[model samples]
Target: MRILLVEDDAMIGEAISQALKDACYAVDWVRDGQSALSTVHRQRYDAMLLDLGLPHKDGLEVLRVLRAKKHSMPILIVSARDAVEDRIQGLDSGADDYILKPFEMAELLARIRVTVRRNAGIAAPTLSNGMLSLDPASREVTVDGVATLLSAREFSLLQALLIRPGAILSRVELEDRIYGWNEEVESNAVEFLIHSLRKKLGSSTIKNVRGVGWLVSKGE
Candidate 1:
């Protein structure tokens, strides 16, 4: 899933970004509320981690504006403000959850999962396309009842493709989902990863759309 993290503290942002990446999330982090607002307005995200204290604009104002614009994306407040009134105000501002700073990474991740599931109206842990199944929580993939082990990048690539079966995803879009925005992308990285995934999953599972992009067919 994609997440936007709005945090001003460099150290805390780095830590949360790394943790979210480790959990296989596409994260876009901004240092201030203005950048965060710009990002949320421009791109789609599964959830948001917002910090109250921010430069340029307060995070509360950011949330308020988003709600005013009718952006229904799930938002979780992650702030150093632990006071009861602060939490109440954050929720009143339309935050889905409130998490105080110095929180456990595991707890934060758990909350994110809940928010994503709630937004997507999903109650299951497994996502499937035909006989192929993926367990997002376990990072496991199974094709036609057979378990297929994949490298981290390979798994990420397949997950991205499978999530939107039959939809053509451009190389740039795939790269954005598989690798961080700051990472150096090899010229043929997407092609290489697609080749590898096809080899493991089945040669006919993924379709190349000529010059357009790639797509996982709806059924085998």
Candidate 2:
């Protein structure tokens, strides 16, 4: 999934961005709140990781502004503001979750998954479309109860489709899910991933809409 990361600390920002990439997320990071606001307006992100102490504009104002404009993507505050009131205010200002600084990367990743799933109205940890089951935590897919291994990019492409079964995603849409800023995207990357997934799962598991795009059926 795509994520917008807002932080002012160079070290922390680099670390977090790398971790997200390692976990197979497409991340675009900005070092300040103004950039954060501008970037969010220009691009679609599945979720945002925001730090409260920011330059140009503070993160709280950023959160309020986005919510005021009716931007509903999940926002998680990652700040050193540890006071109870701080947490309450961040949430009240529209943060879906709060993670204090000096936190574990594993916990932050887990929380991001929960927040994103919650926003998508998905209660189950594993995403499924009848014939295929995907566990985000394990990065594993099961076809008819049998485990199947997938390369990271393959898993990402399938995850994008299974996130909303029956919804068509064009080449650009699927590419955005698997690639991040500054990453090289080969011309046939999307086609390659889809072809690979079909072979591993089943030829008929994913369908093409002729000139439109691709989708997975919302199976029973």
Candidate 3:
């Protein structure tokens, strides 16, 4: 998954960016609300972590603008604004969730998972397509009830496919989800990941469209 992190605090931003990357998310971070808006207009993200206090433009204004423009990606407000009204305003202004500063990294991750799942209209914590199951929190994949370990990049690629079973994703789309700005993408990175996943699962686990992309079947 890809995330847009809008934070002004250098220390906090660095910590959050590293944590998200460790969890297999591609993150692009900006220090101010204007930069956030500019980045979103040009790039797509699975979700956004926004701070209310920002320079150039306020985060609330950014949120309203994105929503007004019909950008539906989930938005989670991470702010020091802990007042009751502040929380209410954040949500009312279109934030999917709110987290106060000095919060646990684990909690923040859990909330992001929940918000992303909610936006995808998936109610379960684990993602699955009849024959394969992926646990986001555990980063574990189970093939027909048999647990299988996967490298971080392999898990990332498979997770992107299983998120929307039966839907094919091209290399570009998969790369966008798996790599963040500044990360080097090798020439055959996507192909290599797909090959590794297939070997670990089954030869037919992922299907490739000769001239298109790859997909996991929607059902067994």
Give every collision pair in model 3. none
Model 1: ten consecutive residues of lowest lDDT: 120-129
lDDT of each: 0.85, 0.93, 0.93
* Candidate 2 local lDDT, 1-220, one digit each (tens): 9999999999999999999988989999999999999998888899999999999999999999999999999999999999999999999999999999999999999999999888888999989998889999989999878898778898889989999999999999999888888889999888888899999889999999988999999997
Regions of model 3 farther than 4 Å from truth: none
> Regarding TM-score, does 1 or 2 come out ahead?
2
- How big is the positional error of residue 48 in model 3, measured in Å on the Cα after superposition? 0.1
TM accuracy, model 1: 0.86
Candidate 3 Cα deviation (angstroms), residue 187: 0.9
**Whose TM-score is higher: candidate 1's or candidate 3's?**
3
lDDT of 1 by residue, 1-220 (tens): 6789999999999999999988888788999989998888787777899999999999999999999999999999999999999999999989999998899999999888777766765666666668688777677889868887677788777777776777899998888777655768899999998898888888887889899999887775
lDDT of 3 at 176: 93
Q: Give every collision pair in model 1.
A: none
Q: Residue-pair clashes per candidate, as listed?
A: 0, 0, 0
Candidate 2 Cα misplacement greater than 4 A, ranges:
none
Each model's TM-score?
A: 0.86, 0.98, 0.98
